[model samples]
Target: MIKKLAIDDLRPGMEVVQMSSSLWEHLPNLYTQPGPIKSEAHLKLMREQGYQHAFVEVEVPGEPLEKRLDAILADRMKDAPIKERVPFDKEIEVADRAYKSAMNHAHRLINDAKMGRKVDFEGTVETVDGIVNSAVRNPDTLLCLSKLAQYDDYTYGHCINVSAIAVVFGEFLGLSRDELTRLGVAGMMHDLGKTAVPERIINKRARLSSAEFEEIKRHPQYGYDILKRQGDVPEDVLEAVRDHHEKFNGKGYPANRHRSDTSALARIISLADVYDALTSDRSYKDAILPNKALAIMYGMRDQAFDPLEVQLFIKCLGIFPSGSLVKLSTGFYGVVYESNPNLPLMPKIKIILDQDLRPIPSELVDLAARQAVGDENLEILECADPTDYRINLKPYLTRTR
Candidate 1:
C-alpha cells in the first residue's frame, strides 16, 4: 500500500497517486522528487499512463485528497483569514472608481479634440503626471490601473494602458519619478492626433482605403500642431507623441527612420503602444494573446522595436499578464487575478469551472506554491481564452457598495 502523506509531509522519496475532478496521475514527488504539480491534467494523464505512486488534489468530500486540500485551505485561512488572503472586493471597488474617473476624463479630452475646441490639454497631462507620480510612490496603484482595461472605449482604454505601461517601463528603465510622470504623459498623448481625424475614419470598422489611410496618417502632424499650440508643453513631450509610430526600420508611417533617431520616451511609448494594441481587440481583428503578441514583438525586434526594450517590456508584463484567462491541465479554466511580482507567470487564480468546462462553486488556486508542494504530476495544458469561456468576472470580483 502506498503510504499517505500530508502535502507538507511530501518529500523527495515518497510515492503517491494524485487525482482531481478531471485527472489522476502518479508522481514521485509525494515521496522522492519534491515540487508542486504544474497543471491539473498532469495528475489524470499520469494515472492513465500507468503511474501509481502519485498524490492529487480534489474537492470531493470524504476523499483523502479532498480532506488534504481542505485541511491545507483551512490551515491557510486560519493563518491568513480569507479576507486577507484574497481582498478582491476592496481592490475591485477601488479599481472601479479609478476606471470610471479616468474614462470620463479621457472621453471628454477626446471629444474636445473632435470639436476642434482646445480644452485643457495641459490638464490631461497634469492628470497623467499625478497618476504616474502616485504609482511610483505606491506600487499597488499599478494594480488598480491594470483594471482600467475593463472599460470598453478605445480612447479611454488606450489612455489607461498607456499610462500603466509607461509607469512600468519607466521603472524598468530606472527613470526618476519626475521622468516617469513625463514619460507617462507622452504615452497618454501619443495618439492625440487621432482626435483630429474624421470620426468615420477613426471609427471605421473595416480597413481604410489608401486615401483614408493617408488622411489618417496625418494625425501625428495634427497632434504635433495641437501640442505646439498648447502653451509651454515640453518639447520632448511633443516629440514623443508625434514620433512614436516612426520606427527604426523606416517601415512605420509619417517618417520611417531607424528607431535610433527616436527620442527615449518615443522608443518606450512605441513598444507600449504596440503591445497594448496587439493585446487589445481592434477594428481589424480580435485581441491576440499577450504571450502571442510578445512573440510577435520578438519577431519584430531590431526591425520595428528596440530589441532591449522589447525584452524589458516582456519582463515588465510577465509571461501572463493580470486579467488573462488560463487553462489548467485538468481542462478547467480560470481568470488570473493577482500575481506575485517576483513570479510574474504563476498567480492566484479564481477558478469558476472544472475540467470539461462545467461551472462549479468557485475557488482560488495559488498555482505557485500549491502545485509545487508535492505534485510534479500537475501541469498547465495551455492558456485559455476567457472571452470564449463566457466568464463574467465582475460579479465575483466586485462589491457594489
Candidate 2:
C-alpha cells in the first residue's frame, strides 16, 4: 500500500514510491529518484529540505496517495477566509475605473520598455495603487471584471488581469496594504521581458521551434536586466519578474531555482500568470473555462506550482469562478455571479435563460440555499461554454449583482 509518512517515520529498506510533492524535484543531491530509503541520513536530508511527508510503499495498511492528498487539500480549504459578500453594484464601478487605468499604464510601460526608454516608476506605482485599493475594498468586483478577456490587445489586458488577480490573492492571504501594493506591481511587470523579444516570435500562431522556444525562455533574464538597469525597482519586484516562470520542482527557465530559493512574490505571480494565460483566449488556442483552468492547475500542483498556493487559489475562486456559464438541473442557464467557498458546487448565480432556452429577465439564485431547502432540482448540472450557447457573457459580467 502507498501511504503518506512523516519524513521522520521513514525507515531503511522502505521503498519510496514517489515524491509526494514536486517541491523536492530540484534537490537531486538529496533524492536522485524514488527508491529504497538508504539510511537515517536520507530522512534527515528530506527534513532539512523542508519536506514534511512522502509517499512510500509499505506493508502497513493505508489509503492511496491521491485520496490522502485530497483530504489534506480539503482541510486547507477550510482555513481560507470567508469575507462578507459585498454588493457587486457598489464594487463594479470602482473596479471598472481601476482596470482601465491599470491597462493604460501597462501599455505605456510595455511601449517604453520596447523602445529602450526608462519606465515611469511613479506612474506604475500609481496604477498598482489603484488596483490594490480596489482589491482591498471588494476583491470579487475586480476579480470578476478581470475575467472579461480581450483578444486584440492581449498584452495590456493580461498585465492588468494578472495585477488584479495577484492583489486579490495577496489580500485573501491577509497581506498588509504595502505588501499588496508590491505584489500588484510585481504582477504588472512580471512579463516585461517579453517586450525585448521580437514581435514575430511573440505573435507566432504556430508551434514554436526548439530554438524559438529557447529564445522565448530568455525573457525572464532579459526582463531582469532591463529592470535592474533602470535602478529604482524594488528587489522583490525584480525577483518576481525574473523568476515568475520558475516551477516548484526547480525545472523552470532562466535560473531554474527551487521553490525554496524563490521569493514568495514570484511564486504568487507565477500562479496568477499561468491562470490568466490559460483562461484567456489567444490566437493560438481558444480559452478554457475558469473551472477547467483550475482543474488543470490542480493537477500540476507540487510540480509546476506550489501545492498550497494552488489550493488557496481554488478556495479563493471556488470550482466555478465568477463569470462562468453553468446549466442547472432545473433546466435553466445562468452566469456565476459569486462563489461560496464553503459550497463550491453551489454558487450564487444570475439566471438569464429559462428551461426552453429562451431569453428571460435576469434573476439571482443562491443554489446553496436552494439545496438546503431540499430543492434537489436546483443543483448545477455542468458548466457550459458561452459561445456554444450564443450567450454574451460580457453583459452579465458587467451587470451589477
**Best candidate (score: lDDT):** 2
lDDT of every model, 2 decimals: 0.62, 0.79
Structure candidate 2, residue pairs in collision: 22-302
Flag regions of model 2 displaced more than 4 Å: 1-76, 149-151
lDDT of 1 by residue, 1-401 (tens): 12233444334333333221121123343322234554446455544554444332222224322223334333432222111232554445554555566667678767776777665544455456555544544333354355324767767788767776777666644465555666777777778898888889988888799999998888877888887776445677788888888886878867775665667778778888888888776667788877788889988888888666676666656566556667876777766666554565566676767787777777777777875797544445566665676665555445222
Among these predicted structures, which one has the highest TM-score? Answer: 2
Candidate 1: lDDT over CA atoms?
0.62
lDDT tens string, model 2, 1-401? 24446676778888776443344465444342578888888777777877766555556235422234445445556655567645776777777888887877888899989999887654676678888877877787777787864435888888888888889887877665666777888899888999889899989888899999999999998999998887657677788899999999999988789988887778889889999999887777888988999999999999999888798888887798887888888889998887777788988889988887787888888888888999867878889887776767767667653
* Minimal lDDT window, size 10, model 2: 60-69
